[model samples]
Every structure is written in C-alpha cells, then in structure tokens.
Target chain A: MNAAAAYLTSFLRASYRDAVAGWNRFWFAPTDPATLAMIRILAGAMLLYTHLVWTIDLEAFFGPHSWVSPTANATFHEVPKISEIMEQDPYRGRSFVWSLFDVAKTSQQIWAVHIVALVTFALLTVGLWTRVVAVLAWIFAVSYVQRAQGALFGLDQINTMLAMYLMVGPSGACYSLDAWLARRKNPRRGAASPSTSANIAIRLMQLHMCVIYMFAGIGKFVGASWWNGTGLWGGVANLEYQSLDATWLAYWPHLSAFLSHLTVYWEVFYCVLIWPRALRPWMLLIAVPLHLGIAFFMGMITFGLIMLVGNLAFVSPESVRATVSWLFRRTRPAPTTGG
Target chain B: METSSRPKADDRHQACCPWPNELRIVVSLLLALHVSAIYVGPFSMGAMGVTSPLALTLRRTYRPYLEAISTQYQGYQFFNEPGPSHLIRYELEFADGREMVTGKLPDIDEHWPRLRYHRHFMLTETAYTLVSRTAPPTPPPGLEVGTPAYESWRQFRDADAALSRAFLKSYAEHLMSVHGASLVRLYGIERRYPTPEEVVDGIRPGDKRFVSEELLDTFTIDIEVVSP
Candidate 1:
C-alpha cells in the first residue's frame, strides 16, 4: 500500500510539472512583435477605408432625416424593428449612450467628427503614440457602429474586433515609426524582438477568432437552409449581392451542395483543427481561398480581405519575420558593383 | 555591434518580452469582460455552455460596456433562412392619375459602386434580425380568430404596422418625390419563397418560379415627409 501511494504521488507531481511547463510555453513564450505590428498596419488601413466609405452617402445614412432617423436607430437596439417582423434579435437592447449621434446633429458636425476620426486612424497607422492612438481608434470604430447600427455588416463587426485587439497588443513595436525612433535612440534595439504585450494581444485575437468561427459554423449548422445544402446557393443568388450572376451554380446543383457543406464543415471544425501543428496548413489552405471567394463572388472584397487578415494571428511570428525578410531581399536592388 | 561581453541568448530572451505578471492578470480580466459582454448573450450561449448565474451576472454587468463598443457581434446568421420574406416594392401615382411601380431602388437593387450600398441591404436586414420572440402578439384571453379578442390582437399588430409605415413612408417619399409623383404607395412582401431544397435541383433564375404572387401586406404611405 505504501509503495502504491508513493507511486501515485510521484505520478501526480510529474503530471503537474508537465502541465505547468506546457502552460508557460503556451502563454509566456517570447513572441516577435512584428506579427502584431503587421496586423496593426493592415487593420488600421482597413479602419480608415471602412470609415471613408461612410463618406459616400454620409448625410443620407447618418442624417436625422434619413430613412432610419436617430430615434429609430436608438430604438433599433431596444425593440424589434417593425419592418423586420420576421427577424428579431432578443439579445440586443437599446444602447443608452451614443458618442457620435449625441455630439453631431447636422451634416457639418458629422463631417467634422468624421474628419477627426480619419486623422486618428491615420496617426494610428503610422504608430504615433500608439498606446493612446489604439484606444482612440477603438472609440472611433465603436462610435461609427453605434450611430449606424442599422448600416452594419460582417466587415464592420470584424473591423471593430480587430481594432479592439490591436489596442491590447504592443502593436507598434516593429515595422513602425515607434521602432525607428527607439532604434535611433538605443542604436542596439533589435527590430525583431518579442513583446509580452504583443503575445497577449495576439493570443486574445486567436482565441476570439476561434470562438467566432465556431459560432459562425454552429449558426450555419442550426439553420434549416444549410442542412438542405442550399444556403450558399441562396447567398449567391440573392439580388442584393448579385454582382456577377452566379446563377450558373444552379445548373450544377451537386457542386453547389458540395460548396455549402464544405463551408459548414470548415467553419465548425476550424476551432478544433487549427490548433494542431499538422492541420494548421490545411486549415489555412481552406480558409484563405474561402474568404477570397467571398470577396470576388459576394462583392464584399474589403470585408473578405479583413477576415482573411484576422486569421493571420494564428501564424507564428517567426514565419512572419521570414516572409518579411524574403520580400525585402527580393525587392532590394541588386547590390551595386563597386566602380 | 558589441564584440566583447555580449549578453547571452537567455539574457536577451528575458529582456525581449519581459511582460510583468501583474499586467497579464489585468489584461486577462479585461479580455474576460470583453468576451462575456459581447458573445455571452441569450442566443449565443448554446455553444459555450455559459448558463451559470455567475456568467449571467458577469454578462449583465459588462454587457452595457460591451454594447458601447463599435465591434457589435450579432453574428453572421446570414443565408440561414428558408427564404427571404420582406420584398419592398414602391409605387407612385402622378397628379395626372398615371401610376408607376418599381422594384429597383437606390439602396436595394441599384446603388452606385455596388459595394458602397451593400450596407443599405445590411441595414434593411438589420431591421429584420432574428429575435426568437413571438412574431405576432398573442390573442387576448378567451379570444378566437374573427372574435373581438382577435380585433385586440389586430390593434396591437397595427400599432407596430403604423410605426413601420412611418419609417418606410419617409424612404418611399424620398423615392416617389424623385419620380415626380404626388401620391405614394408601398408594399411589404412576407414570403416563404421555395427553400434551397426545393429549387437547387437544376432550377434557373430565368425560370421566374420562386417569386409567388401572394401579397402579404399592402399599406399606403399616408403620411407626408420631406420630398427630397
């Protein structure tokens, strides 16, 4: 009995040690800031572009006289929209505070607030006081979403999450003006060092992204249309997104079903399959093309691109560094022969 | 570059990402709040198994702050329907008594640089986001269809209908005024068009078979708003 108890204790100790070691490696291992920095620039550009698009019909959508007035927009959060009697989201409630709607009443006020938002996004892209700018960028993103909750799509949601996550990381660490300034002062600051904040930020994005896919997949599974294997066909054929009439897909019904089922399966399994070392490459192969197809076929190119870029958080910083170095070497002019 | 007395790799690793333990705890807490507030709603908890009272408390506590963020996560419940029900059609009657009908609108079928106005479609869809609550007001106690109790339900529904009519009148007025019309007529279609299961079997778009001639709701925009 003594021998058995001693063995059990020894086994428990070893298991605990192993688990602690694994936890530390997963969470605290030093990660290059370059990956987070890259996401910052891309997501920042997306931010500016997303807000700039609002300028197209700014008055028409955000103006008080527009179809959905400010009061209606506010009520959108609280009650089911009368027009949309079929689709009701019980989870949402009326937002109590609105930074954008409360402050800007007229077009000029809206434009003024918009211009300042654009400037904030521009500064964040260049990494000036990134810590401060990141927070402001998130606020700007939230304000737009709140003011025009009716005008939101998947891309808008993705942009908000990316901006939120960017604020959490040391995203301005490398490939940024902050890095250049730091290097100038220290002279020995490595361009590709790890930042704990960056790692934490990336991890949050990673986990959040997994959750997103899992839900997206599960939502698809629950819908009767997806099970019938006609969801993709409906999306493609919808007149609202009829850029290139993919009605030809109707002719190939089996092919359409295959694509639909593939999407559902891919999304549901993404959270599980993406974690394995061997399966990651496979996941990327399926994911990258899927979003690209969404961009080309759905005419939501920006939204698709943003979703694809968000997936890059799963990539190791080492791989990101190597890709950057390769691009630089290829673009660099052939070394000039000494005259 | 320093050639002598250079720090070893271990020293460099320690310095590279020296994130203090305290900050990690703080950020982790914030992330938890964020996740709870945004994703742990009544509808979304099916996958995460977040039914506990503690989770409910955390969601209620942080939900206000989360809702304030721009990153609204209603989830992409798109293309999950058997078919779209709302088909908005516009009609205009000129002072001369000539009438015109159009299915195309600036934000729906024809918007410049198509991508820009996709949000218009999304906005319309947002108006119809699926809330699991009952779509119709239940009949009053001891009330059956065609009875006075049924009329009470009808009144409740009409109240909602009036509100919707006002919102659409503002938009339809904008559309009709552009077409030089004096009177505005709008139609809201409630359709359960054939599902993917019904039509995916070699059905073509030119067939014009999916759209049924069933008129669900036909209401005139009786209110007057700005023409432009």
Candidate 2:
C-alpha cells in the first residue's frame, strides 16, 4: 500500500512537472500589454455579470412557473441540472465536518464578507492594487463557494478556479491602470525586463492550471456517466436540465457517445500527453477546440474561454511569435550572418 | 574614418518601440457580449452552441409583460385581478387571522402600499396560504413570478441555513457561556455528501402519524406554482 501511494504521488508530481514544462514552452511570451488586458477585462466582466444576473429578479425564464424550480418539494427526483451532481452533491454531507470553514450563515459578518468579495472582484478586474485584489478575490470566491456549501452551482466552481489561476498569473500585468501606473513609475522597464516576483507569479499560474485540468478529468473518470459514455450525452439531451436542444446530437447519436468518451479520455490522458515534447503542441490544439465546444455549446462560455486562455500558458515565446506572425500575414526577415 | 562614420548610422535603431499594443477595448466588448448573452440569448441556446447575438437581442426586446388591474383585501385572504399575466388569482392568510387580498389597499391616498401589478402562468387553481405565526407577508403576485424575488428567497434560505450550521458548530465552545454543556446540547449532523435519500429523510421524519393521506398529497413534486 505504501509503495502504491508513493507510485501515485510520483505519477502526480511527474504530471505536474510535465504540465509546467509544456506551459513554459508554449505560453510564456515576453509579457504583452494586449493579451494581459484582454484576460483581466474578460475575467472582471464575467464576475460582474454573474453577480448582476444573480441579484436581479428576471425570473420569467427561471421563475417558479418556469421549468426549473419545483413548486412542491419532492423526496427523490431527477435533478434539473446535469452539472448539479458534479458541482454540488459531492459536498452535501449530513453533518458539518468542518464548520469553522463553512460560511453558510446569515450573520451580518457573513454579509460583510460578501461585500468585500464584490469589491475584490471589481478591483481585480480594473487591475487596481492587483496583487492584493488577486489574493482577496481568491479568498472571497473560495469562501463564498464554501458558504454556498453543497448548493453551489457550476459558476461558483468556475469562479473559484478562475480566482485560483489569477492568483498565480500575470493577470494584472497589462491593460490595468495599475500596470500603466507601474510602467509610468519605471519608464525604462520593457517587456523583456524580468522581475523575480512576476516570473514566480506567472510560473505558479501555469502550474495551477495544469493541476486544475488534470484533477477535473480525474474527477469525471470517477463518475459512472463518463465511463458509460452517457455523461456528455445526458448533459446535452435532458430537457428540464439542458438550456438548449443541442438535439442535433441525435443525428449522430453515436457521435454524442463518442464525444463523451473522447472527453473522458482527453481529460485523463491530457495529463499524460501535456508533458511529452513531441505531442504537447498537438495536445494543446485539441484542447483549444474542446474548450471552444464547451464555451459554444455548454452555456459555459466563460469557463471554456478562460480555460482556453489558461492553455495558452503552454506556448513558448518563439513559437508564439511564429504563430502570431502567421496569423497576421507577416514574413520573417532573413538573418544577416556576422554583418 | 569610414568605420567611425558607420557609428553615426543610427542610434535611433537601438530605441525601437517594443511595447505590445492594447487589446483592452476589444476584449471588453467581447466580455460584455458574453455576459449579456445570458439574458438575451435563447434560454437553451447557451447549452446548444454559440447562440446568435442578434436573435438573443430580438427575443429580449420583444418579450411579453404582465400587468395587474385590480386588488381586494379581505380578513385572511387577499384577492387581486393582476391583469393578463396571472393565470389564477390568489388569497393569503396567517395563523393569527391577519390576511391580505389581491385587490387594492384600503387607503388610496398612499401609493406606497398599493398593488402595482399581477401576473401568473403555469400554475393550477389551487391556493396556498402559509400559516406561519412569524412569516412575513406572502410575496405579491408580480413579485413571486419574477426572478428577483425567487433569488432573494434563495439567498434568505442560504443565509438561514448557514446560521443553523454555525449554531451547531460551537456546541462545546459556548458551554461555559450558558449554565453548562448539559443544559443546552447541539448535535452537528455528519453527512459526508448527502444523497437524495438523505435530504428527503432529513426533511420528513417517518415517525409522524398522518390522519389522512390527502394532506400528504400536497407534497407531490409535479404541483405547479399558481400565479395570480
């Protein structure tokens, strides 16, 4: 048993290291203002939008009369959301195992924490006091999720992961007022100017994203739905649960099953393939489409897009330059030999 | 002299502009679109594939609105003709005999307490009057059908649940604050990820005897929310 534990630990560590190395090769470009700006704004806007939708009374679609809410509670029934099991049910312990960490309370103190979270998200988006904002946003998001207990929705999980990623990345390095100010304070600092702090931060984010994907995939495998090739199909097909028909999946019902099987394989195998030198780029390319599918089809646009952005961490500067130039229709000039 | 002349060819080349361009505005627009899609996009469109933004906007702009016409207040029941949006009219009652009807308030001079609107759909003709001694005024018709009130109710429930969980946590710590741990004991439930069965068992204890099954019939999951 001890040997098995060691083997598992070693495997996870290898996976982690491989994922980081891939990220460094693919994603770590000499910090660009444009890329950084887009990431921060997108993340911030998503946070704000979630809060707005949650706070508003636009119940026409999700109201009691609408299909989602149950008028009278039932003992045992099919859940209205496919993600509910993955997102909420795992934590629905009967007794409070760790009550102090639980924020499920109506106390003024709890509300105060919520307010702080709202502020933290706002600050994190604008890149104002970014380091502090990142810390606070991560804390607040995790705490809010913890407070929601087992009732947490998919968005909460996504938000928690996003915050975790942001804490380790150069999320506030560009397009932020803070970044602009920092640049102004030190005009000579250029893209190639490396700071120990920023380097550490970026590396951490890359490592964190790898773990997130690997763990998520591992969790899916643990569930029967993934193994049976019914998870993705069920998610797309259920009427009360699915937000859209996506019934086009029926035309190639076999395709749906294939996709589900593919997802599980991709998740589990991604951890293995992400680290291999020859296969890393191909694996990343596949990941791009998978994430896009999630964004486009799952009403999980934010999560998909964010994960895609996180995948960018695997790209290297030279390769990125080549890719960018190719995308922009630019040709590289020939190098002069000892001019 | 020729080599010295080459030195002056251009110091300006060394000062090349390498700063990356700003994509903030474009990114911001895309983010805004992504967020708005939640409301305007086909409710199910999100679950399908990228919903058409144009279609989403059109649906939102053209969505129907429910309006309320009249309201009547009675002893334990409130009656209101909340215009066309409501399918069934409603009356609310309290255990203490205080009730409000669907119609207008008693005083016309004050606009604050007036019934603004009413609308309901997908609800049966049944009436529900929660007989709570401490319950606040049952939510109004227009309010109940809307998302805000429901979310508020969820928030309220979550907050209350949190408090209950906390109260159970410090069972030993608060022992001295009271007479002793013996006087007041709190048992925290140890449910390590509750299954559907556990949630049901917790809400409805099997020990209670029912006089008739008809009372229990109200607990059916298929019952729809009546909108008045």
Candidate 3:
C-alpha cells in the first residue's frame, strides 16, 4: 500500500510541475515585437478608416439629434427590472458601460471628440507616441461602439478587440516613427529587444480569436441549414448581403456544400490545430480564402478584413519581418553597376 | 554606411525567458483571471441555449471589468444562422401641409461607402430584434398560472414590451425631428432570401412575395417638448 501511494504522489508531482512549466512558457516567454508592430499598423489603419467613415454622417449618428439619442440610449443601457428580480442583472442598479458621447451633448462637442478620436487613431497607425495613443485608441473605439450600439456589427467588435490588445504590448518597438526617432537621437541603438509584454499581447489576441471561431462554429450547429450543408447557400442567396452577385453558386450545390462543411470544421478545430507549428500555417492559409470570400462575396469588407488582421496574431515575428523585408527588396530598384 | 546590429542567434535564445520569477508569477495569475473572464463572456452567451451555471457565476463576477472594457457583449457568433434581413420603412407627414415623404432605413442609393449603409442596416436589424419577442414559454406540467415560473415569464413579457416601445418611440421622434414632420409611421420589413429551389425556379431573391412587413409603431411630435 505504501509503495502504491508513493507511486501516485510521484506521478502527481511530475504532472503538476509539467503543467506549471507549460503555463509559464506559454504566457511569459519574451518575443520580438515585430508581429505586434505589424498588427498595430494594420489595425490602427482600420480604426482610423472606420472612424473616418463616420464623418460621412457625423450629425446623423453622433449628434444630439442622432439616430440613437441620449434618452433612448439611456433606456437601452438600463438594467432590466426582471433581470434584477432574478438576480441576473449584470449591471446591478447602475451601468458601467460608458462613452464620451454620453457627455458630448452638443454638435460642436461631438465633432470635437470625433476629431480627437480620429487623430488618436492616426497617431497609433503611424506609431507616434504609440503607448499613450494605443490606450487612447482603445478608449475611443470602445466609446464609439458603446454609444452607437444600434449601428454595430462584427467589424466594431474585432476593431475594439485589436485596439484593446494593442495597448498591452510594446507595439511601436519597430517599424514605427518612434523607432526612427530613437535611432535619430542615438545612432548606435540596436533593433528593438524582445519583450514578455509583446508575447502576452499576441497570445491574448490569438486565444481571443480562437474563442471567437469556436463559438461561431458551435453556434451554427443550432441551425438546420448548417447541418444540411446549405448554409453557404443561405449567405449567397441573401440579396441584401450580396456585394458581388454570387447567385451562380446556386448551380454548384455540391461545391457550396463542400465550402460550408469546410468552414465549420476549420473554425471548430482552429483553436486546437493552431497551436502546433506545422498546422499553424495551414490554418492561417485557410483563413485568407475564408475571410476574403466573405469580404468580396458578402458586403462585409471591413468585418472580413479586421478578422484577418486579428488572425495575424498567430504569425511569428520572424515570419513578419522576413515577409516585409522580401517585399521591400522586391520593390527597391536594383543596385546600378558603376562604370 | 549603417551597420546592422541585429541580435545573434545565441543572444536571441538568451533573451527568450528574461522575466524575473516574481513578475512571472504575478502576470501568470493576472493572465489566468483575464483569460477566464474572456472565456466566460461567450460561455455565458451559450450556444444552443445551454449555458452552464458556472459560466453565469464567472460572468457575474467579471461583469464590471468586462463592461468597462466594453467586452461584455462578445458573442462572436458571426453569421451563425444567417436568416432574413431587415429594413425600416418610414412615412413622414409635415405639419406645414407638405407632401408625405417615404423612405427606407438603408436605401442602397442614398447611403454610400458600404460601411455607412451597413450601419443603417444594423439599425433596422436592431429594431427588429428589440420588437420581435417570441411567445412566452408554456409553463411546465402541473405549474398553473400565478406560479413562480409563470410570473417570471410574465415579467419578461412586460419588460420586453416596455423596451420595444421605448426604442420605437425614439426612432419615431428622430424621424419627426429630421423631416420637420409632426406625424411619423415606422414599419419593420423582413426580407427573406430565396431558397436554392426557388432560385432555380426563376424566382429572384428579392421577390416581393418573400417580403413581409409589420407596422412597428406610429408617433406624433410630443406636445410638451415641441411647446417648451
């Protein structure tokens, strides 16, 4: 009996040690900031463009006489009394959801805040004062989403997700104006060092993406169309959602069904398959076609593009740097031979 | 000439695990709490109406943090069940005896740069979601009226009605303000897509037969607000 107990204790000890080591390695290991920097430029550009588009109808969406006026917004954000009775009121008596628009009651005030938000996003994109601007960008992104909850879609969610994580790391460590400024001040400074914070940021983005797809895949199981593999047909035939007419897919039912099944299987297994180095490439490659298809075929170009930006978290810093360098080399003029 | 001072392979390897043990522990604990919050957000918004009690508890515990970050509503269920699309049709009557003006929420020609159109599209969809409350579930066997189950369902119904009225009224008021209109009427239109069989049968996806409309509400300019 003593022998058996001793063996069990040893096995438990080994397992516990292994688990701790794995956890530490996964979350704490330092990584080059190249991947995070690239994500920042892309995501920041998206945030800027998204807010810029709001300029088209600034008064209609965000002004005092906006689509979702302050009074109506208050009602929407109020905790339902029924939820309170059931002890399920997430916000209790008061709401924590906030936005600058909550206080910007006048058109002038709204426009002022909107301009500042646009500038913050542009700064984040250019990597100027990146740390401060990254945080500001997140605050502004969330503020817009919270205030205009009626006009949101997956694009805003992914935008806020990317912006939130960008604040968690040294996202301007390289490929940024900050880097250039630093080099100008001290000509001998080396490339940006690796950082645990960068790793944490990228890991969070990758895990969050996995959670999104996992839910998305599992959620489809509740629908009969997904089960019968006609889910793709539903999207293709939706006149409102169609950007480019893909009704031709009606004739290729087998191909449509194959794509539908492939999407579900890929999304469901992404979290598991994406961790392995060998499978990671295949997973990311599949993302391009899936997301691009949505971008072109459906009318959700911004949503599809932002999702692809989120997927970039899975790419390694080394790979990002190599790819960027290769593109620059191809773009640069060949060195002319001196006579 | 500028010399590249990139770190060597050995240097890079050495830099991989530079965090002190104490910092690692703190961050690990924080990460554990954060990732738990992240998972709980979607888990609480369960698939197939099968949320676990544990997910609810965790979500409640993390509610404040999630709300502050505006991550509380992270369902991530994009196109999970792409069903019928929605649009709001509005008719406005001006107090100045002007002709009635009529329009849709997302007139494809009026809203440009697809994203703007999408925003308007979402407004109609949000209205549909708010107003389209299903019938309350039938009470379980042996549970008659006035029981806890029945009362709970009744409270939900009442709350939903109040919320929907608030949204529709606000939308009506906006239209009145926008068009100098004293009277506003709003309709929720559900645009169902054609099935593959229907498509093959020469019926277009946007056939009027597939469109269904329900009058959501009608509102007049609030006398109190207009006089004040």
Predicted model with the maximum TM-score: 3
lDDT of 1 by residue, A58-153 (tens): 777777666566766665455432212222324433444456657798978988888989998987888877888999898888887877755677
- Could you tell me which residue pairs clash in candidate 1? A77-A93, A87-B129, A87-B130, A88-B129, A88-B130, A88-B131, A89-B130, A89-B131, A142-B70
- Candidate 2 lDDT tens digits, B1-228: 266545341342222212222432343354344333322322312321223455434333322110000000000100111111111221222234444323211112322111111011111111111111112335445666457656555444443333322322221122212222222222111111222233235522112221111110111022222221
Question: What are the TM-scores, per candidate, against the unseen true structure?
Answer: 0.78, 0.44, 0.93
Candidate 3: tens digits of C-alpha lDDT, residues B42-142: 77777754566676667667877787888887887888888999999998888899999999989889998999999999988888887876344564577
The native-contact fraction of candidate 2 is 0.00
On DockQ, the stronger of 1 and 3 is 3
> Is candidate 1 or 2 superior in TM-score?
1
Give DockQ per model, in order.
0.27, 0.02, 0.52
Off by over 4 Å in 3: A81-85, A88-91, A337-339, B1-16, B48-50, B134-145, B223-228
Which portions of model 2 show Cα errors greater than 4 Å? A1-41, A57-116, A168-170, A185-188, A218-228, A317-339, B1-228
Winner by DockQ: 3
Ranking by TM-score: 3, 1, 2
CAPRI docking class of candidate 2: incorrect
lDDT of 2 by residue, A1-339 (tens): 999999999999999967644433333333433433345566666675554443322222122222112212110111121122112333232211121123323334444555566777888888898877887776665543332222223344445545655665566765577877888999986643433234433444455455455545655644566665556655444321233446565556567678777776776577578777799889888888787776555445555676776666566545654565686565566667995
Query: Relative to the unseen true structure, what is the C-alpha lDDT of residue A220 in candidate 3, on a scale of 0 to 100?
Result: 86
Q: What RMSD, rounded to one decimal, does every model reach?
A: 6.5, 21.4, 4.9
Each model's lDDT: 0.67, 0.41, 0.85
